[model samples]
Target: MRPKQVFVANHTSMIDFIILEQMTAFAAIMQKHPGWVGLLQTTILESLGCIWFNRTEVKDRVDASRKFREHAHGDDNNPLLIFSEGTCVNNEYIVMFKKSAFEIDVSVCPVAIKYNKIFVDAFWNSRKQSFTMHLLQLMTSWAVVCDVWYLEPQTIKPDETSIEFAERLMISHRAGLKMVPWDGYLKHSRATIL
Candidate 1:
C-alpha cells in the first residue's frame, strides 16, 4: 500500500480549510468553531470524520493529538488535512507551523494559498468580528481572489526532529507566497494580553 498522505497549509482565513476540502476527500483537524459555523462543524464536518478541539483547552488539545496520531496511522483511505499554523493570519505573513502534523510518519504535501487584497481583506479577525461579519464583508466586496500552489510532497528525514521537519515545510510554503515568517500564536497571545 502507498504511504499515508498529510496535506498541510498556511492558513490565512476561515475558508482555507474549506478550499482545501474541495480538492481532496480528506479528514481535517480543526478548531471547534462557534455559532452557525459550530453547528456545521458538529454536523457536516463531523460526518466527514474531522477532528475538532478547543484551542484554549489543554485537555482538548491533548485529546486531539492522540486522536490525530491514531487517525494518521489507521487504515483509512482518506488523507489528512492540517492547517499547521494553528490559527489564521493576515495574507501578508506566515506564522510558525505547529509540529504535530510533521510528527506523524506520513508524506506531507505543502499547499500555499495567497490572497489578493485588491477588493477586500480576507483575514478573519475573529476577536474583532464574527464569521458572519466576515462573510457579509466578502459578499459586499467586488471579489476574493487567491492563488493556490501544491508544492512537491515532503518527507521527514531519518535524523530530523518534528520541529525541523515543520520548519522545512514552512520554508517550502513560504517560497510560493513570499510571506513574512512570524509566530501566529505569539501574535495572538500578545493581542489577548493587550
Candidate 2:
C-alpha cells in the first residue's frame, strides 16, 4: 500500500486513462482498495460507482471531494490514482491543469507513460489524426515504450490545480522530451469524458 492516494501520469494517450476506466471510476484507476473513491469523469453518464467529478466538479463538486476523502481516509481497499491534468492535449508539452487531484493532502506518486513514435506523433491535433485512423494503427502495430518513472512520493499541498500539478510532475520528464497532447491516450480509451 503506497498510500490512500496515488498521483499518476497525464499520458498523451487518452486511451491510457480510458483503459483505466474499465478498471475504476477514475478511468486511470485499476482498483479501488475496497473503500470510498473519487475519480474524475472525462466522459459523462458513466455509472463508475465512485465519486464522479466533472472537469473539477462538472459532475458535482460537493460529492466528488467528500466521497474521495471518505474513501481515502477510510478503510480503503485501494489507493486513489488521479490524473491531475484533467484534459488530454496533443502538444509536446503538458498543458494547464486542474487542482482537484491535488486537493487531497496526501502523497503523490508520479508515473510517466512512454509511447511508440508512431503513437506519439499520432496524438492528433487536426482531422487527420482522429480516433478512427489512430485505433486502426494501434490495432495493426505494436506500441513503443518510454520509461515510466515512479518517483518517490511527494507531500501534496491542497492549493494546486490539475494543470499546476501536471507541470510539477513534468519535472521528471527526460530532458528535451517535448510534450504532446493528451489525445494519444484517448485513442485507446472508450471515449473522452470531458
Candidate 3:
C-alpha cells in the first residue's frame, strides 16, 4: 500500500496506547505479521524521525499537510499509525474518531484495548512527565489490561469520517473480548495507575 498517515484520535482517555504498545511488543513473538506497529501520526512523533506527522512551525503544519495530501497515494513503507480513538477513554467506551479516515484512501487496521484493571492517577518525580515515562507507567502497571484483540483490515470509504469508521471498529473489538465498560479513569504517573 502507499505511504499515508492513519489518525486515531478518540476521546482523551489516557495511556490507552501505552498498553497497546506493550501488547505489540509482546505479540511480536507470536507469528508472522505485516508492517511495523501503528500509531497516531502526531507532529511530535514526526519531529523525532517517526514516520508519522511532524510538528513543524505554524506555517509548516500547513506545508506538511499539503505534502502528505500530494504524495500520500504514491509513498509506501512509511505510512503513519493512527490512534483512531481521536480522544481518550478508559477502555470502557470510546467517543468517536476524528476525520482521519476520510483524509486518505487506504486500508485501516483497528486495534481495541481492554484493561482488566485501571488506575486513577499517580505521583511523578518529574514536574512534567515525558511521553515516554507515561508509556512506561502503562507497561509496568498491573492495573492495565493484559488482553488484546486485533480486527481484520477493513475498508474505510472515501466518504466516511474517522468517527463513523472508528466507532464501528471500537464496537466490534470490545464485543469480541466481552469486556465490560470502565469509567472514572483519568491520568496518572508511575505511582498512580501502576
Candidate 4:
C-alpha cells in the first residue's frame, strides 16, 4: 500500500478546497462554515471525512487536532488536505502557516494556488462577505482563472522542529506566491471582533 500523504495548500478562496478535491479524493480539516455552507459541511463534507472546527473555540481546535492526527495515521486511503494558512488570504500574498500539519511525523506535499484578477477577484474575505455572496459574485463574473501547482513533498529533517518544517513549506509556497509574516489567526480575531 502507498504511504499516508498529507497535502497542504495556500488558501485564497472558498473554492480552493474544491480545486484540490478535483485532483485527489482527500479528507480535509476546515473551519465550520456558516449557513448553507455549514449544512454542506455537516452533510456532504462530513461524509467525505472532512473534519470541521470552530476557529474561535479552543476546545474545538484541540478536539479537531486530535481527530486530525487519528485520521492521518488511520487506514483510510484518502490523503489529508490541510490549508496550513488556517484561513483564506487575498491571493496576493501567503500568510504564515500553522505548524500542526508539520507536527505529525508524516511527509507533506505542498500545493500552491494563485488566481488571475483580470477576470475576477477570487478571495472570499469572509469578514466582509458571506459564502453565498461570494458564490454569486463568482457566478456573475466573466470567468475565474486560477493556477494550481503540486510541489515536491517535504518532510521534517531529523533535527528540525515542526515550526521550522512549517516555515520551509511556507518558503516553497512563497516561491510561487508572495509571503507575509502575519499569522492568519489575526484575521480570525478581527472577524470575531466585528
Total colliding residue pairs, candidate 4: 0
What's each prediction's TM-score?
0.87, 0.59, 0.49, 0.89
Per-residue C-alpha lDDT of model 2 across residues 26-139, encoded as one tens digit per residue: 423322222222222423423443445453334365566676666665544355666555555553556444555566666666665554565345354434675556766666
Best by lDDT: 4
Q: Using lDDT, rank the candidates from best to worst.
A: 4, 1, 2, 3
lDDT of 4 by residue, 97-151 (tens): 8889988878789888888889889998777887788899999999999888777
Q: Which ten residues in a row have the lowest lDDT in candidate 2?
A: 30-39
lDDT of 1 by residue, 112-187 (tens): 8888889988899888997788999988998888778887799999999987787777544453455445667776
- For each predicted model, how many residue pairs clash, with residues at least 3 apart or on different chains? 0, 38, 26, 0
Whole-model lDDT, model 4: 0.82
Query: Candidate 2, after superposition: displacement of residue 20 in Å?
Result: 7.5
Candidate 2: residue 71 Cα off by (Å): 3.1
What TM-score number comes out for model 2? 0.59
Order the candidates by TM-score, highest first — what do you get? 4, 1, 2, 3
Residue 115's lDDT in candidate 1: 82
